[model samples]
Target: MALPIITGFDKGDTMKRILTSIFAFMLVLSLLTGCGKKPVIPDDDDDPIPTEFTAKVIGNTSGNLMNGGQYAEAGGWVYYSSETFDESTLTIATGLFKMKSDGSSLVKLADGAYRSINVVGDDLYALTQDGVFTMKIDGAAGRILPGISADPMGMILVLDETIVFLTQSGEIYRNSIDGKNPKELADVNAYGFYYQDGWLYYGINDASYTIRKVKMDGSSTTDVSTGGRDFVFADKRIYYRNMMDNANLYSMAMDGSDVKKISDVDVNSINTDGRKLIVSSFTGVRVLNFDGSDDTVLSDEYAVTLSIAGDFAYFVSQDFSPQHNKLSLSSGTLENILKVRRIDPQNDVVMGSGISDPYIVRMGDWIVYRDSGELTKGIYKVKTDKTSKTKLIDAYAHNLTLIGDWIYFVNDSLNNYLCRMKIDGSEKGVVIDLPVNDFVMKDGWIYYTDLNEIKIMRAKMDGTLISVIDDSDALGEIKLSQDFIYYQTIGMEAGNFGIHRIALDATRKFTYLDDSIQSFIVDTEWIYYTTKVSENELPMQIVRMNLDGSQSVVMDYFDEYVNVIGVGDGMLYFETWKNEAGSVNRMNPESGQRQLVFTSDLRNDHTVIFENNLITLKNNEDGSVNVYLSDLDGNNRLLIVE
Candidate 1:
């Protein structure tokens, strides 16, 4: 989900304009598409097939719960509260409701300025503008939970005796059901609360937007990092949106440990029947294990399908294109395709196209690629066999990585903010917003270079921005290890670059690794960099030094060109270029044994070698750059995307 921008109402007004335009467009479509044609109903004897008249009014404005359902459940009944933003002549607002599994038995349990609700036992306890109230299943006699905050955000039934709720001040509390001595548990200030087992969980609205859990007594507090997303309780665990990454699903224990990100895409909703977890991503619905194993999409896939799983999924899938076939992956069959009606995104624009840096990452099922194309930009998840193509999101995206079920990326549409969505395109939220360039991630945190000031910034997966690790604007080529992050900071003098290091586990206090260098790379034990002596001279040598800035020596005897390095398979692979031609060189780091792997033609300047082989961009005689792969045996082959 995109992070909420805490800005002025100007952007909100702009969004309202956009939404108004959409509404006008939909209104026009309904008038033109339906009103223009009226089917002549024959008399009772000649009527079409003797079926009852069926009319469905589905619109963002005037829709019963067709495709727009708020929640989902597996075995348990799903509860939803509905209020029309604009309804009829009166403009109705503020209502609380519940529904059965299959969109039946919609019971309006409360009304008039109710905030949120909690279901415990046969009663629904919800917050109204004035106070908290409880009512029976059929909206029968109601009574107030006396002596609770009137400004309650929501309610959670932790146990028979306890009710946890959030106040307008962002504070959380747990009190007896009778409201005896409500005790302040925590001050989230920006988030609400959820109760599971003996722990109380809440989202911290500070630098990380991180969800955390604590013992009911508030003795132990632990960060349950769901990449900065919100949490839903089901099947003895907390399922949450990946706060910092896209299209991700995660869950953890109630006590905050044993956190596991379960889905690869944005899990739109989760319904767990204790035995199976039915989850909905943007593309469709699937069932997963509580531990996030054995995930299977439960919906049919003829046309594009959105959310699905169990009942909640069944409700959510109604929102997708009407023409959908039930897809049975087990039998590889598509049947009962439904004819759907939809408002296409393409209809809003005439012609649009762009290209994205195709990023490939290895996760659960296959190698996922976020095709960063401009016009076709979206996060696409396909099995390694190239089957089951799920369009995660159509929003503009940048670099992406899949950690567990979520894909973290930079959304260009949202100010290049770090964002994530469910792999199925649900729960699109921001991780953090940064004015940065060339961002990267390690462990669970994001690191990037903000172009405006050259300072490096860090944030959690859930849209919480942390400036704890600030550096000078001259920073570049930053890389992080488990313990330290290394980068080169350009000095104020023209052509002066110095190696720098900062302990990751510490408070981000940086220390210069070396004061004498132009560019460098840090390995486990050594630092390799390029430097020159005189002002006019280019790189005089590629030098190696201890990480502590001592015991420096020139390694590669090269001058006047660009050098690239990679280390793998117990060897150091380096590329040195003379103009546009480059040679692939290798060295055994331990023995100092240097050897030339291979050399490419002058046209192949940008060469990369991996797995003891060379790969280069070859400019063929036809004036096109084609990539070629070659091995030590002199066997070369052209690599094509197709």
Candidate 2:
């Protein structure tokens, strides 16, 4: 699916070229066919269907089938289309046509690329390169539907007098038959839709793998199950493919209960004729009993899509030269055949937000980060192996912290409140009602300095049990140690400016660690922090104190105060000296030795460390910063995103 801006859709250069060529061809055709009778497209409000029209009962062949569902077999004929747009004439050649089941009697219904094809009464309705249109099934009197736009990213469904489609711009709109009085049903990245028994069901992937159903009136939406498109509703049961289960077949009751794995035979698309299922797969086209028994291979030719209408099922090949073939369901005979993304810093355009500090988080094998660059400004997740990168949600996000199966972050676009969603970008919701200043997670509890309250607060992972842990005027950030919460604090009168600690559990014991803490990080057995000496001439002090207050030792002194950025493996520390613009250095805690290993503008904050790697920013000459993932020693760097 082409994503919209944030939710934007990318038409890409290929779509542009196809449209351009279509326009060129259409101009010539119009010039050659001038003075010909125009196709009469009816408007229900103005040019209603003739009373003699039957609004026939031909099947709507759409699902996971190849052709993205632009093909259907009905009424002893197989319908197909391939059309394009004309920019100069501002017209869409619908390109609707059909052929006999045996590939004979070729007939053109309309012109150009068409999708969402449906046969109702004596006419056919479909979306062309430019917009929604309708025409007689015999390829006559066709006209564009009055206000509907073109190129919907997802399948469109016609429900009695109403029509529904997912626009490329990311909205599912419902309109009257004449394309009048459109109402937005939802904002979705849907691919398939079905209306049955007063309910409308659609397959959407914006959140999680889910098939959702809503009342025909657009009320009471409910997630049907964890399945994808190409599902079929028959015998009062919904047969769907569970993508999480290797794209295998499954069956469930109407209320989404009694789910049973029907078959382990994986498939790309599926169709059914009451008792048997016709499936398209890499292996070939096959048929089997409804329970997945008595499986039979009808054709050894691989098909990417499968569509059934009336007595036949049609499929397209997955080869270089794709052949659109038809099959007789009763005879099980067939004919016809047809046949990442990685990031490179040099050739690929690596964008940055131009902000010095890029908020980065490491979630398992994926690094989810925030970018504010002109072209790629959003929250995106890229695998550590450079195998895949996906935009999660199209919104301003920050402080991406991972806990359990969820990535917790502040929605900078939604009042800075803490929000969370699954790593797959599903089940997103605001975690806390109040704004969060900064936060740290331990176990399943979220400890943070509440921005509105300006005090240390604690809450469970689900945003419950919200309690004020410390009423003191908190400073800097929150850190989670083994048993205590470490934070900088100052009294209401601005006195007592230093680091303090409190128990993580119920005791909540508070202890004053020291005064004038330049920076600090908690360790398993000791507390490592930085403090400045009295005289400006004196070197800064690096202090290490035991958790039980056993002994205090000055680890070493630096020429200037430093910020303890992060603790790598063992007793090694990553730091930035001078407390301002300085080089990031790696320090050996046991020997008190430090070496300049990386550059840092500080952002004056702790860096993100996970999976034995660290993230840092490199400033470029053009005021843009490129984020890189580096080893603990600041070597073997890789660009984070493209």
Candidate 3:
């Protein structure tokens, strides 16, 4: 059982925090880390294996109490406990279960309020309503060790055959796996107690939460770091949240020397399988590689284990200074997902790629894409299972929004007018004979930013009954949510900037969130966004609000301004563009968890290579861009275009 808070915290309120953070977390389970600095492993791990959840990737046996020992792997099977709280009694309902390694053949082993589950040799050990309970792996011979009470926060820590533990009343000790021969380790009151590799790491129960460590036997107790939490040990490194650095995730040498930032989000609970790490924050539970790549939301709501099945890739990636430096922008070579010009009329810029235009969309196994390259400068649809590639339109298209049987897009080759074509390359015609900017389509209705009138316009599926929703301040990235249209009120000054939403039915219209809102995007559940901080210029906090514009929450913050690019592939993507040097952060829209995926440095040939669809942004002789969409193993050079 992963206690939501430090020992002194109320379990009831802690459970509430876990429930509230799910909204932002799942928004990314739909789409995608960085806490502060791009992950920098100075004494880097050697070699990157092909895939994840493998013995080679983790380089060990399957599973060991990650995520509060709610889950563990032993005897060729993975065991876990499912918990639910009953409000009447204010107690958790628990059930112990197991499954195959490949996520099949699930079976419930036992039923009880289980906590900090573990398995050793032929027996499975777990803390239940009564002391430590030992049961056979097949759910037989269950008995609790005598004399110990049913501590809800009891965690079984295995240290060289001797089980070490920290009590809820702030006492640390060593004992057997059978809960006998208790040897007191330390009498200090620790709030965040953790054990790894025979060492006990924790923080004092005070305002400082000063981090310290000791041996399992309570010897050599000394200060290791300052103001750290969520401590975990893996691969000769200690990872924790550095409160001094915006509460971003950081890792250091065992003796407390080489402290490097691992992630950007603040964490309350964490567990690592030596290779992949699981972290729980206000937003949601997240899974990422050691170097903080392939970071994605594992769940929307807080569970004992928000497990993400395999296909997670191995990561090999960076060194950097403590204070983050943002590269000033000029004319720099870069590759983006949906490359285009900035819609802000005041700025003349070819900004990083974003989803202001859906340059690519998938319908079933068919992929329809918009190309601006010289050779294939139009829209093309290809079938993944078959070799049927069709050039739907022989004209450049932007703002690609597929609605029903038609592809609604801005026809850049046709005076930048709004046009539509049948799903098959037939019945192509102009939908609206006006210049359009960013747009979205839904339920046979079209909403777009009309550059001609500088207004938010709407039209029917067949281009009839055109209407203007709002003609107020200039808008940026118009999105549809619930019954309202959420758009950005672009401005050069602080107060000028606001995210305004107008009801589609034209009944109500108002500015959303606050005036200091910088940039935002709306998903089905929440509006994920960023805001400018009063003290700092580099964009500050990433926040989210519900569709009705209530329950605004601050997800994560950065020392440097991070751009909210687009929401896709089960997560939101943010870009920290420092001139020619930039990195892309994948975020879980709900939980505010972030992981650095792609880093582009002009000096190197290719930078920060992760899993499948390796992103390579290279500059050509004529200041053009070339991107390679391939795999990390060099075997599948699948797709490449200029």
Candidate 4:
């Protein structure tokens, strides 16, 4: 999903105007295409003949699939966003397409980013970056619905000719199917919504997180009950999973009376078909009576989203390799329906926002990196040209370094430990059984800072020859040179925090090269670092010194604190922050000439210089991080995610 400048009322009002205009334009286009007839409603006689496998898929395909959400399916045809994954961004390109139930006669439906897909009668409704749009089952006469600008959060429900959706800011709106007579139903800070029997049910966004309901005509809004995440109306009662009770299934009467618990396990998602409740929980897929009896486990594999159609319960697996599967609700058998392939990042640009701490390292023809997305954290590798992407490990990994046939990394399990595994992701074991802050490899040995002891330690590749190199408790970043271990240490006195170098064998004591150092990078001939002259000043100077600490010179200075990125192409690349904005700058180490290369809202503290491209890890507004690739001059930017 693209990041929008999310302001409260201003953004909402602006979107309203934009949606009105777009809908007007769509109406004109519809007339020109001879689709000005009333919204088509399938008559009882013309209703799709309910087949034995009449279940239809509905929801956003691309974003939802990546985040484990549902897409659209109906009438023996399944529609979804088929996107190529970009390793740089850890996301997928936006493209919607459809295929037959037998996986034949595939066809393209639309081109662009979309979410919240719903199939109503014989038409499809979806939310895009701009607004809502509707198209026929065959993808013709597509037109945007008017009078809505805020992005919808969950499924778009169409009931009794009225379309209902919730905005990101918790506002719910209702509109006619023809994009007319829109009304603001309620603004109870809602997160999810459902419509049944002339009443709209919604879950609130508050400390108690209660469930509420109101008439479809925007009247008599009242608190229905407390404690639920999502609602599924069935058997004349509203069934929901208790958010305050580990997402266990629960149900209540239409008037929010006679509430009862129906399950004991934690659930990730839940759906019902009047008689039975299908739920995906940590224990696996299970079905139970509406009153929480006769529980039967369907599959041991973790499931994501699920739907019920005829006698089959379809769900996607919640694992590294997500696959769509169908279960025979009666026979209790399971079958594979389709294997959802990971998007290829080279040919596709995927955009998303989130908090991230991605690190990258280049090895042979592949660039291995760790993607720290909230939902899709893992270690992935892609070719230099952004092709042949593969996920080598399905865990949160960092500080990647290649040594011979093994890849050493810090795995964040219970505690951060130095772990090693074959490049093919086999025979994985902890090399250092202690918590480590940082590590570097040299001459078949690993030098690292132990987080638990706060000391510098070393061990062989086979976890032998363990020894403490330094007993300092203030060790910072560690890097290895030819015969010296260069690192930073915090000092008790001002101007004492400096760069120190010691012999690799721990025979020589600490040797100080520069003081008041903020960050530094080691090159073949020079050590590029940032130093603060005083505690009261905001500016920091970029300094370069010969490896032997001779001929020290100031390369450049910035008004804000500077962080050394790396040195490449005869230029020193660094990032500076001012007014909460980050800018990438490069300077000639010899001439001291500097220029701004790129600017962004994200701080570029972690970066890798690969060939002629600079890969950076940047934060997104939606609590995700994106890896972006650009030339040395910050041009020709591309996103690569495996």
Q: Indicate which candidate wins on TM-score.
A: 4
Better of 2 and 4 by TM-score: 4
Residue by residue across 1-642, what tens digits does model 2's lDDT show? 000001111211111112212343433442353311222224543422222222224237434222245666666776666432222221123456777766678776654566557766566777554456778778888887765543332355665565666655434666666765555555565556676566666767543567788764456788888755457777688888777777788888876788888778787667776668788666788888877788888887776556665566666555422345667777877753211011111222112111111277775687777765445556677887766788777666667776556677776654466777677887666667566767877766777887656788887776777898887777467777665787787554533556677776646555656467777777788778888777464478788888766778988877765666667776456565454567777677788777777776665333556678877644444323456788877799787653
Error of 4 at 500 (Å): 22
State which candidate has the highest lDDT.
4
The residue-by-residue lDDT of candidate 1 on 1-642, one tens digit each, is 000111221110111111111123333442443421212222442212111212121101000111121222323455444333221111123355555554466566666433244455666665443456777656787887665653332333334555555554556665566665455567565354554444556765565556777666555677766454445566666776665656377776765578676767775344454465655555665667777788776663311112222322323123211222333334434443222111122212111111112244434444345444445555566653446766676655546655545666666544455666555666555555443454556555666666545777775545454664655644566655546777666667532366666665435555554345655556678777766644656546677777766587766556655454656566666666667666767777667787777766644334443445444544445433334445643255445222
> What lDDT score belongs to each candidate, Candidate 1 first?
0.49, 0.61, 0.54, 0.63
Alpha-carbon RMSD, candidate 2: 20.1
Of candidates 3 and 2, the better by TM-score: 2
Q: Which ten residues in a row have the lowest lDDT in candidate 1?
A: 57-66
Better of 1 and 2 by TM-score: 2
Sort order, lDDT high to low: 4, 2, 3, 1
lDDT of 3: 0.54
Clashes of each: 59, 30, 27, 22
Q: How does candidate 2 fare on TM-score?
A: 0.42
TM-scores of all candidate predictions against the true structure? 0.38, 0.42, 0.39, 0.47
Candidate 4 accuracy as TM-score: 0.47
Model 3 residue runs over 4 Å out of place are: 1-356, 384-387, 491-496, 513-518, 565-572, 588-593, 600-642
**What's the best-to-worst order under TM-score?**
4, 2, 3, 1
Q: What is the C-alpha RMSD of each candidate to the true structure, in Å?
A: 23.5, 20.1, 25.0, 13.8
